[model samples]
Target: MSARRLTLLVAGAFCLGACSSLNPFSSSNTKIPALKPLTAVAKTAEVWRGRVGSAGRFVFQPAVFGDAVFAAAADGTVVKLQAGRNVWKSSVDMPISGGVGSNGRLVVVGSPKGDVLALDAESGKMKWRVSVNAEILAAPVVSDGMVVVRSADSRLFGLDPADGKRRWVYQRALPALSLRSSAGVVQEGNAVFAGFPGGKLVAVNAINGSLMWEGAVAVPRGATELERIADITSLPVLGSRAACAVAYQGRIACFDLANGSTLWARDMSSSRGLDQDGRHVFVTDEKGSVHALDLSTGSSAWKQDQLAGRGAGRPRVVREYVVVGDVEGYIHVLRKDDGSLVGRLRAESSPILADIQLSGGDVVVQTQDGSVYALGVQ
Candidate 1:
């Protein structure tokens, strides 16, 4: 899947931020409000830093397994960091983008010319690799001893985690832009729930790729400005009760986990990804606006344009703050309730917001330049 842009409302004069800037909350274009100096709720101190080959174009999101951080570089290298320390960095022949997964062992997906590799988590050694016909953009979801991955060809493949053997594969009717919607697999009892492009929500049997239920979701039809760069470029965020999905030019909707039915839908014409805090779902638009909505009702609780002037990043909830990276390589920490800027982590300059995760109370971030850094309180 391609990178998903944040949802923003661009009515104000400050909205001119570039799509490539690093700060998730950059005020480069718009005169930003005087932010109250951030109190030390969380102090970010750099733990360790490491570089990958040639400073590639994309940084695959990092996945944490126990005390180690697993990251895939643009040069098709997978590096392991143990507790903020570099363990090993292994290079493959092809460039890869998908995130990491594990069944009994660690598994990761590569590119159009790459294979799905199952490696030993403790040692960075490859166990087996399954060749695929398409590129893998989304992270492989692991469940029930199987590694589940969605390919650019609108196909879902299930492989044995132990040996990288094919368990089952399901092909769906995908639109031209369906390759951008990363497959999100959620296990509820015996059924596996995954989202698709061309506005589809499907439920498949976990044991086999048999279809359980399929339904069409509400796609966005808005102004031409919204449609130009609009598409569901992120994986569906699975909430406790519902699976939430945001589209660049489509509507944000929650589907029932039991059956592929729409529970609540919100029109986010320029939105991309959805992050939840158990009760509320957080999202952003292309114009640099962030919104908090009740997960159950899909009603807006709060909306803020603090990241005005430009918008791009996936908002990850860390503790009481919602952390999102911008086009300007800075990570903005916002209060979860009303969208107030709490703190900012100035990490990289040309940062691509891949995926951010917290392990052991420290923030682990992967940059587009194939660099990984760990930050935490002093």
Candidate 2:
């Protein structure tokens, strides 16, 4: 299953971004790497299981807020699960695309027709609906005062949380070729960090929608458009003093949080995404190998290639382990000190596209079929 896709939305010999990825990693020629027998150093136990409608081609991740897990499906079902049981299930009355963004009070999602639907978190009732006039592929982020929605046309809208009214809009020139990713933005404090095509990461003021600073996570290179298809396809991972991101056919880097300056960088490529913890940045490359990089210097601390050729999503850090889900629906836990497989558990048979989230100490992930699973690491 293709996690994300390349929509020329292309003018050259095929498109870029994932087109650069699409060519080399096409499923026809790619084979799932065999998993070697692993001695389970840790144990993963299923805490609970919940179900939602199948996502179809859209990406829907389960959002955890306290004990509540909000998840949606492509078929217009938005279900809020508490303890893996439905607290409330509502319908948007339209096919959904991007979603499951919540900041406790407001649960927000996007419709296929570009409508941004804000629902009350407690009751799962519709609060407000506004259209961005473009299809929403990535989830719309919501908070108490502000809501940031990324439209398919590469525009970000800052909306009023009270009602889905536009506060401000931030639009950028998109590259000719790019990957249409379900990856969204990260909002921390007053800044909203978003990665874009051409491998640029920008910090926008959440209050006023002003550009705080821009950092080049990766600059497009290569002679052909496909080779030049460097785009950041995931959310920027935030650390204490730095914000780091990865770009396909590009690099993995950390930028200074204050000024958006590149703190450290190394040649890397990953459409999947990454996580930052302690002194290391963990990323899954395009071909599905996971690596740990030194946070301060971008040095490669270790690499785990056992899962190569298996589609892996962004990693989530829990305690001393890194947990990731793959296309084959196997959750692999790696030792943080060294990239060794520590534990493995099977969740389903479908592909897991969404990021592995954390619910307290348990790991949570929603597969392509919209089955939400919570695993306790012991």
Candidate 3:
């Protein structure tokens, strides 16, 4: 098969049904209360993993297209893997982070330089490249032929996915909040939903970048709290009818997508990442703790510190487990009901910047070494 066609097939055909619909609130529930801590040396193993066998760290995690995985490393190399086989490899100058976008094409953010490039999904051939206003640290999101990117200068750009042409750019109205979190954009139908530096979540018409609605999320309640808090680092997670933004000052909040109204909010701290099972929303904090909150009422159903260490937690809920990857590269899969450690898988030896993918009866991870691994129950 031609490499381009293979890449396209992998992007569109693989077991991405689990990723396409991220509504955790609607998933089936089988609760298991938290279990006792494990003193036993966790029996963990990697089922099948692939890498370039090169010595370089991958700052960006791999993006999955069906069974295929794509990632770029600090050394400016891009590798594609299917199952456990290294299918193809390519390189660009100083490609620090960024991965394949929604369409399975590799998207690269040129580091120490301000450039963004798109490559053919299968062949690793350059398709297009564009220069932005500043360095890009976060990943880009593609929806409806539009590529929305966030740059270090606290600006958002909407580009035509066909040719990397700039469509519109929106600079933050307030001081450029050091945007460690990537800019998130989701298109439900006609509205483009996105979050900004000042904790404001806004929706713009997809065609013209016209403002539809805007609401501040995760903001300090008053002056008393303002002295203690900072920006929203967690990416905004979209659900069936709502979207959520968790903040650093310990707040878990959700907003209505249609009008940007506050649906629910709670103080949660140093929030890192979020996932939902369609009924319950799961959030992880910097302190290596996870909390399950009622999606509709904003009530806490359960909370536990499943991992405790420096850079130990950023909970990811997939299927039946609360999956967390620590700074040391050990991924712990805990029972979601109460918080029991179901399995532990060491996917990498260095810190992981990529999120976990639960798809097609497998747990997929792309490590900092630019390696992609899949663990499944046989």
Candidate 4:
């Protein structure tokens, strides 16, 4: 072959490899197994299914407030549903990139334009709007009379629920290259917990924004930027005595909720988050394996690997099963005690990206195409 033609061929090969590594749909690295047809073993039925505009790649889940559930779409449609009926539907006139946070009295959402808008929960009327100057990819959380928001730039802001006035701002310098996803902030009593790019988890006083404690769940150690990208992108699962977090290329560790002391650490990695029940914590790892760890010690209870390389979301602990959604719109229910696949269902033809939301006795799933389904098991 000619020298120039050979060089061009080599460059094209490298480009294709890089593209496949980054694309979630690409099965070049690992072949995604065909979904096994499930025979109906559990009585599963859809309680309600609805669509807000197309969500595209943005992650938006429903937030429950008393008798109402609030959800938003990428095209700016927000709806309030109760008892399988839409109470009200409205639009913010701008793309909503984050949120569904509500406290019954006020509902909050964030935009790509850095605007945080609050609406009256009763009538879907705009209460207040404020700017934060950065894109918000995670949902805003309302607690302790404050609405907490985390910007994509790693700045955490506390705003007054009454008028969207800024209460406090916490800023941290971010690494040059880091994971852009966040599990948002978890609030408990007076403490607000959030994860950062460097595998760090911080606890702040929700009332005053003062640092309560900071702990490292995982430490970055590799040479390349991709290898050293240890980001704590998942929501920390809070238990009675401790809180646990997982890092993308790092470890899963539990910290004392009262003082942020490391309780136990395990060398596990997951881009998605973790969930905990009374006895165990469930996490979906980067390879699409789901693990159940003991709540007291971080010991492994069980691990399931049938969905590896299938792009699974975080696991949600339901009544007696752990439910997870995958890229092919399949919902798999595994027995919590043994991690055995017991039931399965399909929500839509699109990918299910957001974590499953549990309401009452039903689980709510949101797809990439903006379909929301309330599934119940009988």
Candidate 5:
């Protein structure tokens, strides 16, 4: 069998096992809570709703440029929407497993087959395409005239934004067993950051892909693979001087952005990502509870367990509220000051696995059924 085929088979087996062990619908000891009817407190209006394509079991978040939004579906359909209307629609002609990263002029996406595609953001015309030779499950980030992508096999590639040519590639050895998910990549100035399976976070030059610093967000500990799983599956949240990251079965830590020093860390576990504002950090724990911690001290501010076992997505902080979605298609709005549930809206009947995007004064959500909705809260 070919190497690609073998990788796919292994991924399939891992997915099956993960579903049996982690799926809230299974007859396991854990029970996913039925969503309670929300008593609306804040006013929410849907700006526009449209379909891109089905995400199936994959995660795909829409990207918001200046006045437009770019979204890609699992079937390779990419759409650009302006003022809630379709501006242009195109396809990569291959299964797009990750993407919708844009910088107004150029939009980039990735496929499970390792194909990285760049398109004109305004015209939806294909500009260039290249292969990274590994599965890209996270959205590609474009910044500093470079496009950064992370593959499932722990390789990071920096490509030229103009022609999709390889600029630099960084590879790290993988553990014998690790989670299939990734922390994705984030760019700040000339530095690009990514989290690895061993709970390590690395910063590199976006232009040359040279290592800047590497720090451990969580340290693996235990006897079994499941017990020792400390993968940083969420995108690292950057603050003014520090970047915070979470690890499954490991601690959430804040590291100094300049020197990779551990600023603060606390015993916390999460499968999803985190969000931070000026004062506090918000995280969704493994059991589906969301906690607010002091950004400077890593002390717990509040914990909201109302959505426990509901398969919550990552948190996105808007002006005064933090927004999160669930596997059941409900968008929960919580007051950032105290972690209280303030408002809830249902986008679709399907599960929402992707991170919610806060665009301008609106929130953009993409459901598993391939529907994208822009909503405004008042």
Candidate 6:
């Protein structure tokens, strides 16, 4: 295999099914909840649709900046779209395992061959290519003039944006076993936040790649290694004062943005991520139930469990609603105040494995079958 496999996992990988659908607790409750009847309170429609190559065995989400959205697929296809039109398209000559990461100037993606490829965002030309020598499962983010790429071996490479030269490297200790995920590093201001295998969230200086502080989202404490698994499998969401993250078989916790102080934490398990609207933090638990928790106290404001076992992805807060996509390619728009389904639309027959991205007043999604749709709810 070109990609380095995780330790002690089945078939050389944990494979929560294809497209990261498997949870640690997937053994129980095998039934996918039947969606209750939804009386639409709002209208939802797909404004436009485009196409890219399939994501294959990995996740490929689009990167939105201004009017341009950059997307890629595992078949070496990288494309830039604007106004639902293809602006530029290029091939990387190699398959991409990770998704598109861009700053509107450079587009980046990770190959299964352990290489990071950067292309000019405007013209779709190759700018630079660098090697980390380990498999990169998550998207490489551009933060403060640095390209931050996380490899499967628990190493983060901070490279120069201009030439892909190594600036600094930060390494972490991986546990004996971990659930493989596409959780990438998120940049909030000058600090780059990342999650580790042991349910630890750390903030590092984006410039020098030095560790600033770390906090425990969930601790490893169980008799067996499977029971002790509590890795944060999603990107840490940032608010004005706090950074929040979720873990598989662990808890959802919010920490101080400046320091690693634990603000509040609640027992929750999810491989998908969360989003905050300054008032409430929105998340979908592992069972596909969406929730709204008080941002101040981590208390449950409301719970919408009608979609349990449907394999919902992260929560994206729009103006007055929370939107989430499920394995069946259904987009559910819920009332932010109350978790009632207000609108629904089916974008693809294939599953939506990528996190939702907001672009040009529409929720943009790249389905697992490589179809891109921009849907709007009103």
Best by lDDT: 2
Least accurate stretch of 10 residues (summed lDDT) in model 2?
A: 16-25
> Could you tell me which 10 consecutive residues in candidate 3 have the lowest summed lDDT?
17-26
Candidate 3: residue 234 lDDT (0-100)? 54
lDDT string for model 4 (1-378, tens) is 986455445433532454332234434656678866666555677788876767765788778776677889998999888865889999999999888788788889999989999989999999999999998888899864899998877789999998889999987766545655636898988898999988999999888899999899999988875567688877888888888999977999989999999988989988877899889989999888999999888899999998777788899988888889888898888888999887888867788877788887888877878777789865
What is the C-alpha lDDT profile of model 2 across 1-378, one tens digit per residue? Answer: 332233443432453333534333233555678899989999898999999889997778888999999999999899989878988999989999998899999999998789999899999889999989988988878877899999876799999999888999998987767776778899999999999999999999999999999999898998886678788889899999999999988998899999998898889988889999879999999888999999999988999988888777788899999998888899999999998999999978888888888999998888888898799997
Give the alpha carbon lDDT tens digit for every residue of 294-318 in model 1. 9989999888787764444667777
Q: What is the C-alpha lDDT of each candidate?
A: 0.65, 0.87, 0.63, 0.82, 0.85, 0.85
**Mind giving the per-residue lDDT tens digits that candidate 5 earns over 240-260?**
888999988799998898999
Task: Score candidate 6 by TM-score against the native.
Answer: 0.94
Q: Per-candidate TM vs. native?
A: 0.82, 0.94, 0.80, 0.91, 0.94, 0.94
lDDT of 2 at 68: 91
Point out the worst 10-residue segment of candidate 4 by lDDT.
14-23
**Winner by lDDT between candidate 2 and candidate 1:** 2
Descending-lDDT candidate ranking: 2, 6, 5, 4, 1, 3
Residue 358, model 2: Cα distance from true site in angstroms: 1.0
Any idea what lDDT model 4 has?
0.82
Model 5 residue 70 CA deviation (Å) reads 0.5
lDDT of 6 by residue, 1-378 (tens): 332243545423454543245542234445666777888997899888888878887887899899888889888999998867999999999989986899989999998879999999989999999999988889889854899998876678889999999998988887777777788899877688999889999998888899999999998879976778888888899999999998888999999998889999989988888999889999889878999999989999999987787888999998888999988889999999999988889877688878999975589999988888899877
Q: What is the lDDT of residue 33 in candidate 4?
A: 83
